[model samples]
Target chain A: MLAHAIFFYIFSLIAIVSAIMVTVSKNTVHSVFFLILDFISISCLFIMIGAEFLGMIMLIIYVGAVAVLFLFVVMMLNVAQQKNQWFSARESSKHIPVGLIISTIIFFELIIVIGGWKYKPDLVSSMSLNIDSSISNTHAIGYVLYTDYIHIFQLSGMILLVAMIGAIVLTFRQRSGVKRQSYFSQISRERSDGVELIDVPSNKGVKSDD
Target chain B: MEYLSIIFSETYKILFLLVPVLVSVAMIVWLDRRIWAFVQKRQGPNVVGPFGLLQSLADALKYMFKEVIIPSSSNKVIFILAPIVTMTLALISWAVIPFSATQVLADINVGILYLFAVSSLGVYGIIMGGWASNSKYPFLGAIRSAAQMVSYEVSIGVIIINVLLCVGSLNLNDIVMAQESLWFVIPLFPMFVIFFISALAETNRPPFDLPEAEAELVAGYQTEYSGMMYAMFWLGEYANILLMCAMGSVLFLGGWLSPIDLFPFNVIPGAIWLILKILLLFILFALVKAIVPRYRYDQLMRLGWKIFLPLSLTWVVLTASFLFYFNLLPIN
Candidate 1:
C-alpha cells in the first residue's frame, strides 16, 4: 500500500508537470514531446491502479498514434520557429477573460464532483456490468464492451470513421495537367499496346507520339 | 529485510535475462553479416574468432575506445539521449516475451499488448535522434521513419487482431497453448505472411529501410552519431529485429512447442526450440535483406496503406467470421 501510494504520487506529479509543460514549452516540438510524456505518466498510473488493458490501450492510441501525428505535424510545419506568446498577443488578449471564466467554472465543477460524490448503498448491485475479481480486467471489460454496451461502442467507432473521412475529404484534390501514375493501368498493359508489326514503322518510327 | 530480498531477487532475474539477450544480440549481428556474405559469395568477419564469432565483441571494444563526437549545432541533450532510449526500449519488450511455458520476466496477462505498446514507442528514438542532430538528412530520415512506422503499424495491429480472435485471450501463454492442436500459420497463412512483411517494415529492415537509405540520406538518423552511441543504435536495431522474430515465432510458429511429439523431438527443452524458431525467422529476415531491393518512398507508403491495410482488414473479417460461424474460437 505504501509503495502504491509512493508510485501514484510520483506518476501523478510527473503527469501534472508534463501537462503544464505541454502548454508552456517554448518549442512546439518540445510541447508535443511533453504531451507524449503526459500521456505516458498517466498510463503508468493507470497500469499501477490495475487497469492494465486501459493503460496499454491508452498508450497505443494516444502516445503511439495521436502524439506521433502531433509531432509529425509540428515537425513538418516548422512551428518551432514561431515564438509562442501566451499573454503578449494584444489582439488575442481579448479572449483571455472568457477563457479564464470558463476554466474556473470547469475547475469548480470538478471540485464539487470530487468532494460531494458518494457511493450509493446498493451501488455494487445496481451496476448491470459488474467487474468480477476472479477474471482479469481485460476479460471483464471485453465481456461488457461486446455485450452490454455494444451500440454505444460502435457509435464511437462511427464517429471516428466520420472524422477520418472528413479529414480526407477536406484535403483530397485532383489537379489538371499533373500526370498521376495509375498503377493498375500501368501494370495491366499488354504487349500489343507497346509493339505493332506495321510495314512503314521502321522508316517513320510509326508516328511514335500517337 | 523482506523487501530487500525481493529487490535482489528481481535484479538477479533481470541480469539472468539481460546477459543472454546481449550475447544473442552480438551473435545475431555476426549471423546477419554471414548470411549477407553467403548470399553475395564473400567472406564476412572471419578473422576475429572461429567463423568470426568474436567479431561483434571486437567491434564493441572499438566503439568503446572511440570518441563520441556530438555535433556543435546539435541539441546535445536529446542527441545523446536518443540511442540510449532506443537501446533501452529495444530490450524492455523482452520482459514480456516468454521463453518457455514457465520462463518469462513479467508474464503479465496483457503480454502481447505490452509488446505492441513498446514496439510502437520505438519510433520516438529515431525521431528524436533525427531531429536533435540539427541536420537535414537525419531530420528527413526521422520523418520517413515516423510515417513508415505509423502506416505499417495499422496493418500489424489488424493482423494481430486475427490472431487474438483465434486465441480469445491476450496472454502469451494462452496464445501458445491455444495453438496446441495446430500452428496458426497453417490456418491464418495470409495473415502470417502479411504480418511477417509488416514486421520487416516495422523493424525498418532492408527493402523498407528508407529511413537509413545510405545512398540518399547518409545513414539517415544515425548520420551524426558515431562510436558507442552508433553501436548502441546498431545493437538496438538488431535487438528489435530479434524481438520481432520472437513475436513471429510466438504468434504463428507455436513458440517453444515441439513440432513433433516423438521422443527425440519432444525431449528437447522448450527454450531451445524457441531459440531455434527465432533463428529460423531471423534467417528469413536476413535472406529478405539480401534478395530484395529497397522500395521507393511512395511505393513503400502505397504498399503499407493501399495493399497491406485492406488485405489484413479483409483477413481479420474472414478469420473472425470463420471462428464465429464454426464456434472454433477459444473460450477462456
Candidate 2:
C-alpha cells in the first residue's frame, strides 16, 4: 500500500509538472515534449492502479505514435523568433492575467473537492479469481469481450474502418512523373520479354548543327 | 520492529541492486568507448585507471559537478523533465528482470510483458528531449526514432509470442526453466536473430542509430543536452542494453541453466550462469556494433517491416503447428 502511494504521488507530480511545462515553455517543440511527458506519467498511474493493459496500450499508442506525431509537427513548424525573450516581460503580456484567474478558480475548486472527499482503497476481491484457477487475465478479458462487450467492440471496429477509408479517400492523389510499380505485371512478366534487346546503329552524330 | 525490518529490507535491496546497476552503466560507457576504439584500431580512454575503467567514473563526476545549462530560449520545465523520464522508465524496467535464481527486485507473474510495456515508454524520453530542446535537428531525430521504434516493436512483439507459445508461460522463471533441456536458440534460431536485431534497433544502437547520425543531424535530439543530463541519457542507453541482453539470455540461452545437468552440477548456482550468459550476449552486441555498417533510413524501415515482420509472423504459425504436432502445448 505504501509502495502504491509513493508511486501515485511521483506519477502525479510528474504529470502536473509536465502539464505546466507544456504551456510555460517558450519553445513549441519543448511544449510538445512536455505533452509527451504528461501522457507517460498518466500511463504510469494507470499501471499502478492495475490497468496493465491500458498502460501498455497508452505507452504503445499515445507515447509511441500520437505524441511523436505532435512533436514532428511542432518541430517542423517555424518558431525561430520565439527563441529569446522566453521568460521576459513579453510572455506576461499574453499569459499573466489569464494564468492568475485560472489558478484562482482551480484553487477554489480543489478546496471544495478535497473538503468533501472520502477516500478508501478497494480491497482485492477474493471472489474475482479463484486461487485454484489457472485461467489468466487475458482469458477473462477475451471471454468478456466476446460475450458482454461484443457489440461495443464491433462498433469500435466499424468506426476505425470508416476512418481508414476516409483517410484513403482524402489522400488519394494521382500525380504524373512518378513511376508506380504494378505487382500483377511484375509477377506475370517473363524474364526474356521483360528484358529489352537494344542494338543502335553507330556513327550517326556527324550531322550536328549544320 | 516489523515495519523497521520491512524498511531495512527494502533499503538493502535497493542499495545492493542499484549500486551495481549504476556501476554497470559506468562500465558500459567504458566498454562502448573501448569497443569503438578497438574496432577503429585506436585506444579509447587509456589515460584513466587500468584500460580506462576509471574514465567513465571521472566523466560522470564531472557531469555531476558541471552547471546544467538551461537554454535561455528553451522550455525550462520539459527540458528538465525529459531525461528524468527516460532514466526512470529505464531503471523501472529492471525491477522485474531476474538475474539468477535469487536475484530479482519484483518477481511478477507477467514479467516479460511488463518489461515490454515499460521499455516501450523509452522512446517518449527521446521524443520529449528532442521537442524540449526546441531545435530542428533534435526534433527531426526524435520523429524518426519514434517511427522506427513503432515499426520494429510490432515485429518484436510478434517474435515474443512465438517464444511464449513454446514456453507456455509469461513468467520469466518458467521461460528460463523451459530452456533447461535445450536453449530456445536451437529451435528458434531465426527468431533469436530477429529478436536481437530488433532489440538493437529498439535501443537505437549503431547501424539503426539514425536518430544520432552525426553527419546529418548534430547529435540528433540530444543536441542541447550537456553534463549530467547527457550522462543520464548515456547511462540509460547502456542500462537498457544490459537489460535487453539479460532478457535475451533468459529467453533464448536458457537463463542460468548449465548444459550438462546430470546430478551434482545441477546444484550449482543458476545466477552465476545467467550473468555469464548475459555478459556473453552483451559482448556479441558490442562486436556486432563494431563490425556492421549503419543502414540507410529507408533500408532500416524496409528491413524491419517488409522483411522481419513477415518472417516473424510466418515463424509464429510454424512454431504453433510444431507444438501442436508434438502435443507440447500447455493444456492450462
Candidate 3:
C-alpha cells in the first residue's frame, strides 16, 4: 500500500507538471511533447491503481493516435517557430482578466466538490457487477461489456463508424487532370486494338495517320 | 520494510529481464544485417568477431564516442527526448510479455492491450523527431508516418479483436494457453498473414518503410539526428521488430507450446520454444524485407484503408459467427 501511494504521488506530480508545461511551452511541438508526457504519467497512475486496461487504452488512444494527429497538424501548419505570448498582444490582452476569473471559479468549484464527496458505506455492495477477484481485469471488462452493457457497447461502435464515415466524407476529394491507373482498361486491351497487319505495307512502310 | 523488499525484488526482476533484452537487441541487429547480406549474396560484417558477432557492440561503442549534433533551428529538448521516448516505450512493452507459463515480468490482465497501446504510441517518437528537426523532408516523413501508422492500427485493432473473440481473454498467457489443442494460425491463417504484414508496416520495416525511404525522404525522421540519438532510433526499431515477432508467435504460433504434445517435442522448455518461434518469425521478417519492393505512398494508404480494413473487418465477423456456430468460443 505504501509503495502504491509513493508511485501514485510520483506519477501524479509528473502529470500535473507536464500538464502545465503543455500549455506554457513556447514551441508548439514542445507543447505536444509535454502533452504526451502528461498522458503517459497519468496512464502510469492508472496502471498503478490496477486499472491496467484503461491506462493502456488511454496511452494508445490519446498519446498514440490523437497526439500524433496533433503533432501532424502542428508541424504541417509550420507554427512551431511562432512565438507564443500570453498577454503581450494588445488585441488579446483585454480578455485575460476575465479568463483568469472564470478559470479560478471553475478550479474552486472542482476543489469544493472533491472535498465534499464521500463514498457511501454500502456503495461497494450495491454495485450491479462487482469486480471478480479470480478473473483478470480484461476478463471482468469483457464479461460486463458483452453482457450487462451490450447495448451501450454496440452503440459506441455505431458512433465510431459514423465518425469514420464523416471524416472520410469531409476530407475525400477527386480532382480532374490527374492520371490514375485503371486496371480494368489496362487488362481489357487486346492485340487487335493497337496491332494491324497490312499486306501492302511490307515494302512501302506503314502510312502515318494524322 | 515490506514495501522496500517488494521494490527491491521488482527492481531486481527488471534488471534481470532488461539485461538480456539489451543484449538480444544487439544480437538481433547483427543477425538482421547478416541475413539481409546473405539474401543479397554479400558477406556481412565479417571482421568484428566470429561471424561478426561483435559488430553491433563495435557500432554501439562508435556511436557512444561520436559527437551529438543538434540543428540550430531545432527544438533541442524534444529533439533529444524523442529517441529516449522511442527506446523507453519499446523496452517497457515487454513488461507484460509472458515467456512461458510462469515466467513474466508483469502479468497484468490487459497484457495484450497494453502491448497494443504501447506499440501504437511508438508513432510519436517518429513524429516528434521529424518535427523537431525543423526541415522539410523530416517533417514530410513524420506526417507520412503518422498517417501510415494510424491507418494500419485500425486493421491491427480489428485483427486483435478476432483473436480475442476466439481466446476470450486479453491476458497474453491465457491467450497462449487457449491454443493448447490448436494454434490460431491454422484456423485464422488470413488474419495471421494480415497481422504479420501490418506488424511489418507498424514497425516501418522494408517494403512499408516509406517514412525513411532513402531515395526520397533522406532517412526521414532521423534526418537531423546524429550519434547516440540516431543509434537510439535504430535500437528502438529493432526492439519493436522483435516485439512484433514475439506478438505474432504468441498470438498465432501457440507461443511457448511445443508443436506437438508428443514425447520428444515436449521435452524442450517453454521459454526455449518461445525463443525459437520468435527467431523463426524474425527470419520470416528478414526474408520479407529482402524480397518485397517498397510500396508507394498512395498504394500503401490504399492497402491499409481499402484492402486490409475490409478484409480484417470481414474476418472478425466471420470468426465471431463461426465460433458461435461451432460452439468453439471460450465462455468466460
Q: Compare the candidates by DockQ and give the number of the best one.
A: 1
Instruction: Give me candidate 2's TM-score against the actual structure.
Output: 0.76
Give the fraction of reference interface contacts each candidate recovers. 0.74, 0.52, 0.96
Reference contacts reproduced by model 2:
0.52
Off by over 4 Å in 3: A80-90, A93-116, A119-134, A184-204, A207-210
Q: Which ten residues in a row have the lowest lDDT in candidate 2 chain B?
A: B100-109
- Give each model's whole-structure lDDT: 0.92, 0.81, 0.89
Separate DockQ for every predicted complex: 0.83, 0.35, 0.76
TM-score of each: 0.96, 0.76, 0.91
Estimate the Cα RMSD of every predicted model relative to the unseen true structure: 2.0, 6.7, 2.9
- What is the CAPRI rating of model 1's predicted complex? high
Say which candidate scores most in TM-score: 1
Which 10-residue window in model 1 chain B sums to the lowest lDDT? B323-332
Of 2 and 3, the candidate ahead on TM-score is: 3
Q: Judge candidate 3 against the unseen true structure and give its global Cα lDDT, from 0 to 1.
A: 0.89
lDDT digits (tens) for residues A43-72 of candidate 3: 998888778888888988898788888877
Q: Using lDDT, give the best candidate's number.
A: 1
Selected candidate, larger DockQ, 2 vs 3: 3
